[model samples]
Target: MYNKELIRNISIIAHIDHGKTTLVDRILEITSAIEQRKMHEQYLDTMDIERERGITIKATPVKVMYTADDGKTYEINIIDTPGHVDFSYEVSRSLAACEGAILLVDASQGVEAQTFANTYLALENDLEIIPVINKIDLPNANIQETISELEDLIGFTEEDCIKASGKTGEGVKEILKAIVDKIPAPSGDSGAPLKALIFDAEYDKYRGVIVHARIFEGTVRPGDKIMMFSSGETFEVTEVGIFTPELIPADSLSAGEVGYIIAGIKEVSSARIGDTITSADNPISEPLPGFREVKPMVYAGMFPGLPEYYGELRKALEKLKLNDPALVFEPENSPALGFGFRVGFLGLLHMDVVRERLEREFEIAVILTAPNVVYRVKMKNGEIVEITNPAKFPNDGEFEEVEEPYVELSIITPSEYMGNIIGFVTSEKRGEFKEVENAGKNRVVLKFIAPLSEIMFDFFDKLKAISRGFASMDYEIIGYRPSDLVKVTILVNKEVVDALSFIVHKDKEYAVAKKVVEKLKDLIPQHQFQIPIQAKSRGRIIARTDIKALRKDVLAKCYGGDITRKMKLLEKQREGKKRLREIGRVTIPQTAFLALLKIGEEDK
Candidate 1:
């Protein structure tokens, strides 16, 4: 038992490509947390997808022993968080595992939107923020300017910043020592019932579900019957372990210790991120509720190209859910995309992780439909429905009113481009500016309130373009509004495909959605029957296009020496065709079906 003062827990937060993981790698190497020569750069990004993409999708926690100047050996738990906005929620939960955070501000980019987004949450949590200026080795590294930004954003002084080059071993040792000296110890009564906030959990085929949790109060050991405060499901702990970043068996985990526990639980959603775990026999009276149900801000239908891969599709999702509990998939039969699942995610990167994981891990090629946002609907009788799938949408006459999810967005950009960004956000994105503040002579921060549905597709792309790629944005769900929204439904062969449909605000630019549907038509090889693709709204058809069958293509002509390529192509097409739940004479893909339900698929 760590009686009074043996544990130090901290989380690292930074914007995308701001050297968060790189710093973590160096810390591990310097502290000997990793085996010599066994470690590589960004070693915390263990998954192939993460390393290849250079982003951390899943949060990883590592335990290291550091000796402080006060001559005390403290057990420090370091939690590495994702830097992208998509994993903001994940970052939020990971903070629950630590008492403090090391905020790395890129010297060149200075403080970014994601940095502001996460730091604000850290402040709300009342956690100490240890300011670190990373990438000091960059030729353009403005250490002085970044330190000033940190002082403004995080209430730290220029002299207090730890200037370090995570790439080179420069001044990184100070960060380790400062973590022990600067950050406060975790505060909670150990006598209380065991309460662990699960930031993340993964399934090991051999060990079952291993949950990574921060013990807020009390200790946990093997043979304890744990209940997920969220699911209310109980399971006996089979193993107790600590993070070597790879699980290492432990005798027990006490308060403030971040570690893993293996239970017999196999399914992923049962061990969701931000869910709390407590002893069922002696359950905590009040579990720490960290968040609302992780709602997918973005939704899309995933289909295998071949109808034969329907089983493969399920297997892929099952395996993905093992590692990615945030990915929600339901066996959805779409008219256009065929056997597809209406998959939900926290944001765009989260969605991308699922898709990329599916393709890379399963070696299964898939053609995914365009993403759409959830819509809020209210009946005259006051019935509220949050629709994730457009296929489940009620017609206009069937609804008293409808609205979409809205978010309060904050953008930090160069002052030179503020005018351009503001105009584009208001005009092209249906955004209403709330405030604009002078961040510095060359920088400004603009805050706006807009619908989440608007930014789901290419919102960042447009923001980057209008600002000449210098702007950074962050957003949080504010509330729901009566969206002047419409459904863009696509029909092939005059039949609606449910997967191709989605909901969107009517006032925003429809050019992106319009182009996506056109691209879908181009990618989808038509059958013997000429399939007519049409976009509709409220059961009224709006936009129309046709997918003409490719001429002079045969399996026999392409089968020599590259059967795998031919099979993959046909498999994708076959999967799409299967989604065409025969509605009368039309055979539609699920993409067409779901696409039809969003605004662009529908006409004005």
Candidate 2:
């Protein structure tokens, strides 16, 4: 067994673009985890998209050996987590596997919206937080003010905070010393029954699935049979290892140590995140608590641009799902778009990243339909149903009430922009103000309770635009509330396009429908016959637009002829136009459906 006193398991948490990965780079270099010649920027970020986008989409685990000022050695396992709100679940899982965390705050930007959310999550897990002020070398650095904000927000004094820059590696040694001096060693019973928490997992082609876990109570080794408490699936471990930048084989992983278990499992889905592992032969009576399955909050349909690539898209999704259990999909068919899958995501950013990965990594171009939020429908018969797509929404007579998810939203902005922010939130977005308080000299925090559906679509972008990029917001799913909801259906030439239908609040239906029809009018090409685009609610037409047909050149052939002959030619032309109208079809472009994304942007 290993000494729990010398092992420190910690995770790095921060807001987006707060330099978490950069700090990890400096740490690896100072600890000699990699040779100087092999060192590079963002070494732990393994994906090319991550490097290009400058965001960590996945949480990575690594181990390093550091010698402290006390002349003693310590084994530090650093779990780097994603900073975006879309990947908050990743942060939750990483926190479960660590005893302490380094709360990295941008020195100039101060604490952002996501920073507050993630800090609360870490505190909920009972992890000791080491407040670190990062990016101090930048010209706009406001170290003193940021430190004061931290003192107020988390009771961190100047002495408790570390000031450093990820760019020049300033204060790297001191930060390392602080980690050893301030953060407590991990605590666990090595002799107790096996209970390891699987924080992350990956699929390996040659060796099957590899699970990254932290041993909580007992020792785990090769040849030991382990059971996943959540799935109740058991398997024999083929190997045990730890990451030193790369995987290094280990004889065993005892309590308070972070490492990996390689089992001969065929799929990664069998080994899920946040699940507890225990020795099957010497099992624990109960598994560790706080484990819940990840649920998706956003839904959209993805259709292959080319109908022939349907099979390829299916295979790619299966492969991607093996690595991401949170991504759920099922076969969906649309009359306008063809066969595809209705995919679910944790949020909009998650949906974008998955789409990028599919197109860039798998080389498949796909069309995405309008996004929908889950709704709870109460039927007159006293039955409740959950619907994610408007195509499945029941008739008005069938449902007595519709309830949509709501969120507790918090916004941080400068005092000067408070008026604009409040006006937009209350008047256009239907937000209910809770309270407001001053965060610092010129910064204010606004709290509101708004429909999750309203904020889920382009709310952040608009907030930033209106505030001139000085505002940041965060939200948590509160619960479902009754709404004045109606289903808006779009019909093309009298045929309903399921992909173009959606549910909206009844008050905003007219404006939303008007914008959609106007955009569709410009996107659909002209046809031989008039094509009418209509939006309907409860079998009543609410908005309409028609694409006029192109004129025929029937008069070009009649140069000089009798009046009767010219009239006959004109009649024949009219007959031809009627025939064309009978058979003409309107092909809606894929870009037309993209207009639905900006339907609410024109509200103000």
Candidate 3:
């Protein structure tokens, strides 16, 4: 029942620390969406970690009403998206719900790595770009330089850029007016078959899965039977609601609208982001385009600290999975760590976020093993296998060829640190340099074709360290490439521990093995007898260390004893040592496994 011309659906996109959340706060204030006394800084950032880190971790959507000077009231829907490269999927999904995007750039810092990455995504979604410069009130604000960068990198001219400060509340009104004047309203047929794009969803114990979607065509109402285009599952719509910063029940949602639909879906997996929703009775023949599934880029084993809590962890994972469909996990058992789950994530940050949520939300402490990526192995018998866990890797000569994932990586950093970065990526990480170009004054963009395995570790931290925290990066999977990779097994007292095994490039096997053995030697407590720590790959020992024994001086009090008696005592002590060695089991502490995350830290 609303005119498309009076509605504006837009998303705010920017880099981390670029004040996207603050801008949203300013907009809410100007729109009077919330009372002045009730407003707080970063009002859109609902998570504690988000506020603490000053970053938007989740994409949040809200509705605001603004009365223009032209004596017209407009309904604006703003989707505030996270800017970190790790949350690129979330940003992309949020962008899909909008017809235009406000690209907020830091006035002093200009365009960053994520800025370019997110701008490209918005362009990919065919969203109109409204370039805005934020934090212009700062003393170091280089408005001209930032404008130059925008023009050079994103092809935005000076006339297209708007300057604003969320802190001082300057130019905010102009920005909103621009949204009403410049950004095009969503255009769709409200009478067509129902077609809604599911941008996000959440699980509620009482209401089940609440799907956040954008209506592209037709209208949806409560009690209407809805069907998911991808899953082809139908459920009666229980409720339709919109975010007026709070959930408000609505009679119906029409085309060019962003709202939530509850369809009695208990499992989060049933409602996937990027999936299309349609009416069950008159479903569309084809779903919306760009419906790609999210695939995990990293895999790791998560084991409960207490073995008895495995069941509790499983239930927690199931509950969390309802909200996060990107998370994939399966039951796995480890000889050293006992029962655990092999969880897959979009990236390392996703893994960390999931782990944090597990501990904080579920109150379950878990020990994680070294992360790994899937590898394609061609067996000697001509069968191909994809392995996620190193314990499942084939032995040497058992596989004819091994292939590992590769990526096309792009990094933006200051020109002063370019040489060191090139060396770090090409030599230390085994990446091949593709090209380099000027980004702006004293800034450069470097491209490389590298193994995904390298970036999966501490590559980002290393890059940041070398660049003095100014470097930004983004990457895309470039498919699998054949490589000389091996599964390195760690043995304690001649017993292989599946949890400690990991896949490594064959060239760095010896170095990685040496580091692991060294770390384990320091972490493992001294046994009654010497416990040999060995790293073996392809049935050949690559490195070894021993946790020395804590020997008792059994012969100390034998001053008055005969030589034969002393000798017998010594013989008995030797016998005890032999027996202990034969039956001894070394308990590897969790810290040893955590040391794997510090792979290159010592060198740095």
Candidate 4:
């Protein structure tokens, strides 16, 4: 066991691509936590997706022993957190487990949107912030400018900011020393009842659920009976361990320490993130304050390519939920796509990541429908219903009012792109201009209140193109507001395809409907009979198109026959074609569903 007074719990926080993972690599090397031969870039990022994307998706914790200049060994726990706004919940949970944070800023890029958001989160948690300017080795790096921005934004002086290069290990020692010297030690009674907060968890085929937790009081070891405070389920502890970047068996974990505990939990839902664990016999009267539940901002349907793989998809989703608690799904069926689940995600990026993981990690090829946001429908009877799927929306004259979700968007960009950005946001995106302010030298921050659906699909992509990839954005859901929203349904050969239905604003319904019908006309293969593709909205056909039939030469053999014989043959062929058109089915290919996702992209 190590001394609680000598232990410092800290987390590394920064915006996307600001070198948080690279900095952690340098820290691990200087502390001698891993052998030189075993060390690699992003050593703590165990997932292949994280490495391929070059971003941290999960908050990883590791313990390292460093001998300070005082000739004494100190135990330091470092939590590496994600910088994307979609994964802000991960950073918040990590902060709950640490006493301080290393706020890293890219010297060349200066302060972006997420930098300000994460710093405010740390301040709310009452954590000690160590400001560090990273990537100082780059030729375009402006260290003095970054320091001024940090002071103007967060009120940190030039002396408090440490200039470091994550690439060459410059000033790493100063960071380590600052962690040991400035951060406060964890204070708790080791003799009190056992209380550990479950910050994260993962599923294992052999060991079941392995829970990562931070101990607040008492000690936990193998053979002790523990209970989950939320579920009230009891189990005997089978193992206790710590991450030296990899799981290593430990004898025991006491208060003020972070480690993993295994209770042989076979059910994935039992060991939830933000759940509390304590001694079953001598449990604390009150549980520690847990994190607030996160609600998904976007919803999409995920159906397997083959129906037989439904069971496998279900099992895969259950195991993934053990690792990602933000993901939520429910069973639903579509006439066009068959059985599937409606999965909810934080944003478009979150949806893409989850879908990729499902395909790569679980080997499940899933067909995703177009994404949509939650809408509120107030019926004429004064009843309100929240709709995530277009098929569940009420028909016209049935609902008195419809409300859509709205967000408060913040964007930081160079001053030159401000005019174009504001024009695009207000004119094309239907956003209301809120205000604009100066962030630092040659940079400005723009704020807007926009409907979430307007920006859900391709808003970010357009912003990047207009700003030349220099702008960064962050948003929070403000509330729901009344909007003129209508549902657009697609019919292939006069049959409704539930998977092709979507919700759009009333003014843009004709444009969207026309695009969907025209795209389907090109994608749907030619059948034995002509097929009509129609888009319906508000009980009217706003757009229509047809796929030409593949015809056969029925009169080829009767070339020189008499006029009466040719007429008889022609009449007979016409009747057959008519009969076929009445019962023929149009097979909609999977590519058609994928093509619908790009409809909004074309408008841009």
What lDDT score goes with residue 307 in model 2?
Answer: 99
List, residue by residue over 213-296, the lDDT tens digit for candidate 2: 999998988999999888889999999999986889999999999999998988887888888999888888887777888889
**True-structure lDDT of candidate 3:** 0.87
Q: TM-score ranking from best to worst?
A: 2, 3, 4, 1
lDDT for each residue of candidate 4 in 1-604, tens digit (9 for 90 to 100): 5789999999988998899999999999999999999999988888898888888888889999999999989999998888888887777888888899999999999999988888998999899999999999999999998998887778999999989998999999999999999999997888899988888888788998899999989999999999999889999999999989789989999999999999999876788777789999998888878555678888988999899999999999887887777889999997667899999998888898999999999899998887889999999999999998888999999999999999899999989999999999999888999999887777888999999988877788899999999999988789999999888888888888876778888888898889888988888889888899998999999999999878887788985958889899878877887899888778887787679645722342
**Candidate 2 RMSD to the correct structure:** 2.3
Candidate 2: segments with Cα more than 4 A from true spot:
553-583, 596-604
**Candidate 3 wrongly placed segments (more than 4 Å):** 554-572, 596-604
Q: What are the lDDT scores of the predictions, listed in order?
A: 0.78, 0.87, 0.87, 0.88
lDDT tens digits, residues 549-587, model 1?
433354656646666888887776665554543432544
Which candidate, 1 or 4, has the higher lDDT? Answer: 4
Show pairs that collide, candidate 3. Answer: none
Off by over 4 Å in 1: 1-3, 289-291, 488-504, 507-604
TM-score of 2: 0.95
Q: How many backbone clashes does candidate 3 have?
A: 0
Clashes of each: 50, 0, 0, 0
Candidate number with greatest lDDT: 4
Off by over 4 Å in 4: 380-384, 550-578, 600-604
